[model samples]
Target: MKFTTVFVALVSAVPAVFGLTINTPANVVECQPILFSWSGGQSPYYLTLVPGGQSMASPIKSFPTQTGTSYTWNVDLQANTIFNIALKDSTGSTAYSDIVTIMSGSDTSCP
Candidate 1:
């Protein structure tokens, strides 16, 4: 009982210990270079696109990355779809960004 409580408490603090941030558009257009940025956490980091409006148990794409603050993601998908960024480090620590919607086409520019 006591061991279980302490283990649970420590596990819950992983996110706070390795903070991460995402700088990108929540709503994005497909087939474009969507720039992504982050801060904190150990490198080399891994990123994944988890499809929204469905189960998050799996990711659509995953890759290893460096500490670079920015990355370009070429969008290419159907409209009306949503997704969010999931970042992971070598130690199995993970972080998540806010959700974004993928559209067929849009005139909006990425930041």
Candidate 2:
């Protein structure tokens, strides 16, 4: 009976996902257009494209104080480069999006 009770409690425990999420694809091409979207964040939010494999420092590209859930961006980095997107909410909380890699323009798989 004790084992059954413990098993039921363990099975019922589930972690909730964080509210901030990145909606863009994992791959993109340089100098091409890409769309970004997210949900579960407060307005007056901000997102920035930062260099990969580094701490949150200077952002190569930044968006204005955004109130909507989506934004279109033109990537200007070279091919084969890695990057990260930083999202900040009105309360100054920040979250990092999935690491993205920029494909070569010649790569036909990029869209």
Candidate 3:
């Protein structure tokens, strides 16, 4: 019983694993100032817009490096488009958010 107690205590001491995270939904409005947020990984991260079915070598757009966790980004792309945010940290760690589709006007659904 003593051996079992020691094993349990050791396992609980492990730190929680938190990978790079971005909080944007799968769909957003076009031509609006959207709030973007992320966590984990190092600072001075860069962002790129990877269009759906396109190679990562050619991003549609690229943003400046960001050090803060959250920021407001203006979306000027066309509606009914698909894309993803490729986030790369200063240490070369990279992460990609789930695929996102753009919507126009007050309508937020895809057909």
Candidate 4:
């Protein structure tokens, strides 16, 4: 009985144990389009972008959708800057992606 209970508990906790995982590049050029993807989480996710290395309280982007796992973000910010992505489910549970480095633009400087 003890073994069975333990096994069941672990099985039930799988989802919470293996929360969300975001997949994206560590470095990307500025003013380019990139796709951010995630797995192991629920649907109707919210994507928020926060500038890296800053103590900003608000996110740069608060895009919410229930369409797909990948989100296309246009990196039109500044070069050499870092950005972090946060994906949240309907329950307010969130998963964060690794910080990404933005390279210089191939054209004019970012506005």
Best by TM-score: 4
Writing each residue's lDDT as its tens digit, candidate 2 over 17-104 gives 4456666565688768888888765787898888885645798778887898888877677787777888888877676777788887
**Clash count of each predicted structure:** 2, 0, 0, 0
Residues 1-111, candidate 4: write the lDDT tens digits. Answer: 999999999999998777887786655778777788887677888888877744244787677585578887777777877778877887767777677778887764543
Give me the runs in candidate 4 sitting further than 4 Å from their true place. 16-18, 53-56, 109-111
Clashing pairs in 1: 31-75, 31-76
lDDT of each: 0.71, 0.74, 0.75, 0.75
What TM-score does each of the candidates earn?
0.67, 0.71, 0.73, 0.78
Candidate number that wins on TM-score, 2 or 3:
3
What is the alpha-carbon lDDT for the whole of candidate 1?
0.71
Model 1 residue 77 CA deviation (Å) reads 2.1
Residue 42, candidate 1: Cα error in Å is: 0.8
Candidate 2 to truth, TM: 0.71
Which regions of candidate 3 deviate over 4 angstroms? 1-18, 53-55, 106-111
Q: Report how far off residue 12 is in candidate 4 (Å).
A: 5.4
Estimate, for each residue in 17-102, the C-alpha lDDT of model 1 and write its tens digit. 65776665655777666777777777778888887644356987665576675677777556666777887766766667777887
